[model samples]
Target: MDTPQRAGHVAVIGRPNVGKSTLTNALVGAKVSIVSPRPQTTRHRLLGIASFPQGQILLVDTPGLHRDQGKSTATAMHRWMNRAARGSLEGVDAAMLVVRAGQWDEADTFAYQALRQAKVPVVLVVNQVDRLKDKTALLPYLAQVSEGREFAAVHPVSALKRKGLEPLVNDVLALLPEQAPLYAEDEITDKSQRFLAGELVREQLMRQLGEELPYATTVEIERFVVDGALLRIGAVIWVERDGQKAIVIGKGGERLREIGAKARQQMEQLFGAKVFLETWVRVREGWSDDEAALRAFGYHD
Candidate 1:
């Protein structure tokens, strides 16, 4: 008897900062998407592929679904994110809805609504279980979240600590159909190196800068040239205003230097090659709200 192989797509839907990206990375066993503490860190629709002996899962990590977004770029960004996440759910064999353990907000409700509207089979992933002091407290929370909806399985896992992930992956893989793998066995993601490098830079900047300032920043890879064991990458950090640029660059360009150094180190580790990274900050003047600018920066579906 031979082992049956299965494979299909799984859309990991959730509000911002619910560990969706982290879970995607953990399941794939690689850094396919960038992660940050800030909301709206994942701007694009990312695919992280996880392979198992019995099957494989192509996880779709979308921009966080936001609710009650107000005027300006923030609203535009949230709408676009919701669009990306909703679009990912279409045609996917299953959906994984990640919500923080013991908490549910309006944004989470928005995400859940999208999942329900999609009519796709859902796996409710209650991430951050490791943060809970009383493990039994999860029982009622799980029951509440699963109420009035059908879940293939309710997995309580910690994307950060890697706890309870093995079972979660097993359940998710089982949700996929019995078909051949969609991507290559060793291929972790379907994104270009340039896009990933840009994401990495954005991730580091978001982590280093923290709060409000990082939201105004977006990364564009201007150049990616490979020479033997050395990789030269030039990235432009786009900000909506001069003050934001100044903040990103920091005093006498110190913050910019640190961002570059940290990003370069990650790049080297990711690509396994010496990296020559050149970063420059520029003011894009409300580009986030500008639909044309957003599309040009690859923010669209």
Candidate 2:
């Protein structure tokens, strides 16, 4: 009797807000990462495993890559994306480069370049096809970008509408070598409960705050204690400046309370237990630039 072989990893690399998290969640049939309309919402590589009748597919949801001007926070996020993308391609069976449909911009060009450099069996996924009025309009752009390059396949999908995903999944599985499951069939994601809870809080904040705050905020779970029926969790929301902290807490603590309540509701749904979540805003001056702070927050390698 020997251990069975396992399927290899599939890295989903793309620019920010291109529906990477949405596609990862859809593939896994669960929410493993926080998704916001804001750019660079995904700060780390989240592994979501999708199990099919044939085999398992491990999806790596990475942070969006973009050029940052002077924002230290954005610079760090881009570094994270580079790290994940490079590391994931090392021995991956295949890679999917997600690009927004109906656009051929600098960001898309950068993404294409990165994928070309990866040298792995790649699939070009044109996401947000639902936004395209004329689907045929995408052909010229796709053909132009893919002219001299080798892509296992080019797929146009709407991650939001769950359109054109089945084919993508089937194609990905076909590329994987015949092997045993890399992860337990029941385990859908590699993220911990604490990480998921923090992400849920951050997602709500991102939705409510919008671009008023950059990706300078981080949520850390200080304490996660389970006492019988209730979960007692304490988290600190770190901001880069006192002004940002003020904005997060808001006047009379109303906004902070609202964020906490919504986060608690989501946590309960995630944990399947009543949650008592306490969140506090702390100004950690220049946390983005501080190497110690970045390492402590699990942003750095």
Candidate 3:
């Protein structure tokens, strides 16, 4: 006799920069989401599907929940990010809250509120345990976080190191419904190659450029041409102002070139074909706040 098949949706939620995206990638066994050290790097609800012999896990990577200050001055982009992350929890079979060791603030607590309201099986994913200097220090923190709410299970993992992921995946799969696979066994991510290409370019910007500039920037793939085994891509890097555009292009165009090179390499690896990438910077002022512009940029729900 064999174990029954199980498949369902699992939304990965957490505060900003708490390793939610990293953990999702680890569990899915592929780079379904682009990562950056910056907060709110993920702009949408992206699905990373991991199919196993007995079960299939649909891991939804959402934007990190922004920390709420006493006063609500959260920008338009922040509002959108929060709405997206919170919205992903609805209708999901399960939810996982990724938090760092010994770091639980209002944001983590806030995440808990959303999960509790969703009335779904919630798993507490304590990520970045590798950062702990003393392993014994983990007990108190773990016990502390576990005090409130009934988590289906608690998993301590290091998303960056890819450690303790097997157990985590197994545990998450057990919570899924006993059903057939939702996606093909070989398919890892639901995002289109074109979207991933633009995301890769934005990732390069976040990794290579100044902190403030990356937030001001967004990548758009204006054209994608495929000819048999070769792919040609033309992308526009949008910034809010001329000074921001200048920062992205750098003094000698060296910065922009570096971004393009790395992003093109990522595109080639993902598409498994020769890729020709062209990137140019343009100013799109106040696009984040403009609903029409945001819709044009594919930020629609």
Best by lDDT: 3
Model 2, position 183, has a per-residue lDDT of 87
Q: Give the TM-score ranking, best first.
A: 3, 1, 2
lDDT, each prediction: 0.87, 0.82, 0.88
* Superposed model 1: Cα runs more than 4 Å off: 68-74
Candidate 2: which pairs clash?
A: 5-179, 5-180, 6-180
**C-alpha root-mean-square deviation, candidate 1:** 1.6
TM-score for each model: 0.95, 0.91, 0.97
What is the per-residue lDDT of model 1 for residues 1-301, given as tens digits with 9 covering 90 to 100? 9867889999989988899999999888888889988888898998899988888999989988776455643556667777787788888988999999999877878888888888888899999999888889899988988888788899999998888988887888777788888888889999988999999999988899857888778899999999899999999999998888888988999999999999999889888899999999998887777778888887867
- Between candidates 2 and 3, the lDDT winner: 3
* TM-score, predicted candidate 3 vs. hidden true structure: 0.97
Query: In model 3, how many backbone clashes occur?
Result: 0
Which tens-of-lDDT digit does each residue in 1-301 have in candidate 2? 6533447789888877898899998888877877888877887878999987778889988887665555545455456556765566666788898988877678877776776777778888989988988867888877887877788989989888888989988888878888888888889898888888889889878987858585778889999998999999999999988889888898999889999999998889877899999999998887776667878987754
- Model 1 Cα shift for residue 168 (angstroms): 1.5
